[model samples]
Target: MTRCRLCGSTALESVVDLGATPPCESFLAAERLDAPEPTYPLHLRVCTDCWLAQIPPLITPEETFSEYAYFSSYSSSWVEHARVFVEDAAARLGLGEDSFVVEVASNDGYLLRHVVDRGVRCLGVEPSVNVGAAAREAGVPTLTAFLSPETGAAVRAEHGPADLVVANNVYAHIPDVIGFTKGLRALVADDGWVSVEVQHLLTLIEENQYDTIYHEHFQYYTVASAIRALASGGLTLVDVELLPTHGGSLRLWARPEEAAGEPGRRVADVLAREKAAGLQELSGYTEFSARVAKVRRDLLRFLVDAAEEGRTVVGYGAPGKGNTLLNHCGIRPDLLPYTVDRNPYKHGRYTPGTRIPVLPPERIAADRPDYVLVLPWNLRAELVEQLAYVHEWGGRLVFPIPELSIVEVER
Candidate 1:
């Protein structure tokens, strides 16, 4: 992009160019295998002026989320995480049966179900028609719409202002950052809290989690840039917490400027950590491209060697991040014959660009593949436990991001 999406400055520098890849979630059907798939530039750049890392908004959210493929309830660990967050939020905010909560991008009612059980009234604003239907089936009062300024205002007017607004793992999906933030302000009460959970740019660089970069994720944030983004919408950062989900993420607490007092010491401490990691300057990003290249090389070498040795290697999950890694490394079915996922929607589909077949999780046990490459490595602990049966067949698990490592499972 010519100018920074957040600051509107022309001082953007390259962090990494992952070449071109299709929209990661665009799985292919057998009937459409012969049709040409479209791709877009997967380049990430950091703005020297605002320190916000972003990609060109080549794809729109409507194209990706209208009939979303990802169903959040598939991951048991994530659902439990949401449950804990709801319990803690209710206690922290003194929420009761009379309190109201709103969650943006609430996928499949995975989180709001916990809110519903607490006897507190809640609503979910989601764009995808299918997932919204699923949420309604689960008894979550959901409005099928994207969160813009108008939608937020309408929800507030009808339901009254929310006592707490929770937006988890969706801050990076929207191209219009300022407008989305304004919508957040309009939904929340003047004194109510707004909690946003997003992947931290600091952990992304330090851990070499380049696979998470994709077209749907238009921007990345550090606490410093997040403060600026929140300010643009009349919201102020009040407290910060480090979370281990999605490799590493930030849970930022914000409020309207009128009620947002001085930011807590945790916010300043995290800012100091970011500055120490060189995220506020150019030096932090200079070596990321090289590290990303090393990850690509190591993964390809292992897959090729496995194929040459007549040892089968299949993928564990067909997540969006896995598509980026597979497409970037130029892996086809020859290296990874097929992958399996718990989501039934992807059971008979093929991964975008790579065209590798996706099967059910039972296939791993049925086929007894020599190695199962774990794509959604962020859920390592949960998958390791679930796939422990692989040890029965002397199968091992492989993780690609943060470094390439193969682990032996104990039955």
Candidate 2:
């Protein structure tokens, strides 16, 4: 009876199920640890109709994002990524102080601050008050509300239609994918361009990235599903770029359906690549569940072996995706001991489900653990570079995703 969230197709087949798990971002304070915690079925389904892979909307946006603990400014590489994006986008779009820019889900103004610094008029629509307040403090104008058709209309009325609309990493987080795209269509001027960044489904399947399947990420889009969803909302995909961030992601450029422009060759080329890779068929999804199960077994074995050998192991980056991997593999503080993050808001709070203590990065060198299990495998390069000092003690790094590999960092 369950239908696909995007295309409303009842021909939904289970691809990968992570069993019952808590919301990935539900980091718990000491007082809440003693109280009952809730967990939901973290199962993914693929639609035969449109090839859109998604999870049921079991949780609301307010419950998942209203008062968030994640801040994008904490990651040095991610902040630099934002800066580069703004610089490139500004140059490409011919943006200036006279042009208006708006970014949805602009956490902590990590991206918009760069837009403002370039002297472009920018505004951020962020629902999380904690991050929104931080954005305001950083001199970025922000609204503490989720973006929908209604809010998009209000923004258009107040500031006129934006020349550039940015929604990076928010496409997967939104429950109503069609509505969100429609809102983008409404808010963007006919000549304006909309940019959306999402982790490509092909990489998630091909690389055994099941950790990205938590409740907050309701949709995992392929090129086909993304095109269909965007077209449904009167928007058209014009260009596409493959990025290495977040394992692998797609940066799609869109325009109003009525706008006059030719779709870039990258669009057809990407679609052809996806189709050849078997994204349009069920076989591409069938082998995923087995691959995901293998990852869990291998990770558990590695952790158990490390514990039996009496070697110290700790985690780096308490990201939401990390919580999913930790909880799905049934790892607790005993196996992980403690994890470190740069976000001060998450410090002193324990990770959801696994209950691993979140400490400051300074603790990593103080303890000098034998191994640092990197939870955020997508940011492995940045983290590996940041923790290169661990090599001073003959310590190594561990990545749980794609496969379990213990790597040594050379100083």
- TM-scores for all predictions: 0.99, 0.98
Candidate 1 per-residue C-alpha lDDT over 199-229 given as tens digits, one digit per residue, 9 for 90 to 100: 9999999999999999989999999999999
Give RMSD to native, each candidate: 0.6, 0.9
What would the per-residue lDDT of candidate 2 be over residues 37-101, giving only the tens digit for each residue? 99999999999999999898989999988999899998888899999999999899999989999
Who wins the TM-score comparison?
1
Which residue pairs collide, candidate 2? none
The candidate that wins on lDDT is 1
Model 1: runs farther than 4 Å from truth?
A: none
